[model samples]
Target: MTTTKRFFRNKRDGKWLGVCAGLADYTGIDVVWWRLGAVLTTIFALGPILPVAYIATGVIADRKPAELYRDNFNPEEERFAMQTRRAPLRSLKDVHGRFRALDRRLSEVERGVTTQNSGLAREIDSL
Candidate 1:
């Protein structure tokens, strides 16, 4: 027996409630196609049923984890997360190096400020 991943609303790709986007992610189909199909179905025979179903599903489904963090979705952050997941230690090391460099720069700025002449003197000199 195989287990399927539970479907969640893909708030990142979705324009509204992300029902079609969620369906697309779950079924491995393009979101545009799902949206087109939904609209056509809603306009043709299904009438209001499809839209109601969509709304209900959107309300009931959980938001995808990627979209849960911020007010708006960011695909770039998701891509970064995936890359970091692939090489967590390397990513951590890179981040640490960047923070260390920033720390060094800040320390230099602090030292310069502490040892430098007064702001009034510098202003007078610049004139």
Candidate 2:
């Protein structure tokens, strides 16, 4: 099954309204980095502007779905999800490349199994 990637507030892991946490999730960055950036920007740079934007984002963004990562907790899956969210076309190309490699490997295995190649059988038996 395929899921459309969208930004969602991660209230479960968030300290505030999950804006920073959502940003972390979306960008594959640590939540601490997002929180620190927000705090630093609020204090040293944008002042009230940053806070206002954060509040607006919290209010506007949808809460993360409970079933979004429900079944498994795989770090690789999370990384892939983040990459897909960040650059979908690049992710598509990566998946296509993986499938192509797998197809090539499978065809080689089929050839080895279907043909009566003594050398290939001896090589398999040695392993």
Candidate 3:
């Protein structure tokens, strides 16, 4: 099954309400960094607002499904998903560039093959 790139509370890796862990999973950052940031923000800056938001997020967000990362758990796929989420247009452009490169390479190969063997080229063209 395909997993949607949606944020879910990672209770399995959480310390308290899974908020920090969830944030880490969603943003592709380390959980420790998220925890540290939350603590520092709570202690120094936002204070009540941060805590309230955390709690609200914990309450509102669904618990991460166990199977979400189980099937086809590729690190590259995860990174791509994170990148797509963070900057969709950039991801799309990157994909387009890759496809264009691949098309150029394939065209070069076809040109080479056709130039070397006219009969093979005719057969390929017929197909």
Candidate 4:
């Protein structure tokens, strides 16, 4: 199953407007890397454009949900997040496999339920 991940500004860890923090959250990169990259972009004649983009992103991105801050990170979720950062397509295939397994298990449950209902119907008819 493909689930959507919302991009939210990480207010708790942010230094300035949380643009770098948001990018780190989305890309699974260390926040320092993003900050360094922003500085490099500014130095490399990207100039005011980089700062403008950061400001625009800060304005555009939504703040992270309160519940997410409260909830503890599950190991599976963390692993999946890391894997997605490394290889998104590979992780998608892994998700497909998991969904297929779930589908098979659901079909088995439906079959069992149908069988039990039919047996009960026959018992009622005989009685």
Query: In model 1, which runs have C-alpha deviations exceeding 4 angstroms?
Result: 1-4, 67-127
For all predictions, the C-alpha RMSD in Å is: 10.1, 4.1, 6.0, 8.0
Clashing pairs in 4: none
Candidate 2, superposed: residue stretches over 4 Å from native? 1-5, 26-30, 69-71, 118-127
lDDT, ranked from best to worst: 2, 3, 4, 1
- Model 3 per-residue lDDT tens digits across residues 1-127: 3335678998988998998888877776778999999889999999799999999999999999888755656778777776776677898999999999999999999988767787887999999
lDDT tens digits, residues 1-127, model 4? 1223678888877998888887777777778999999999899979999999889888888997666663565767766875797679999999999999999999999998777587788999999
Task: Give the clashing residue pairs of candidate 1, or none.
Answer: none
How far does residue 19 in candidate 2 sit from its true spot (Å)? 1.1
Task: Using TM-score as the measure, name the better of candidate 1 and candidate 3.
Answer: 3
The digit string of per-residue lDDT tens for model 1 on 42-83 reads 999899999899999999989888534455547666554544
Ranking by TM-score: 2, 3, 4, 1
Give TM per candidate: 0.49, 0.76, 0.70, 0.58
Better of 1 and 2 by TM-score: 2
Candidate no. 4 TM-score: 0.58
Model 4 segments more than 4 A misplaced: 1-4, 70-80, 92-127
The candidate that achieves the highest lDDT relative to the unseen native structure: 2
Model 3, residue pairs in steric clash = none
Total clashes for model 4:
0
Each candidate's number of clashing pairs is: 0, 0, 0, 0
**Structure candidate 2, residue pairs in collision:** none
Give the TM-score comparing model 2 with the true structure, all chains together: 0.76
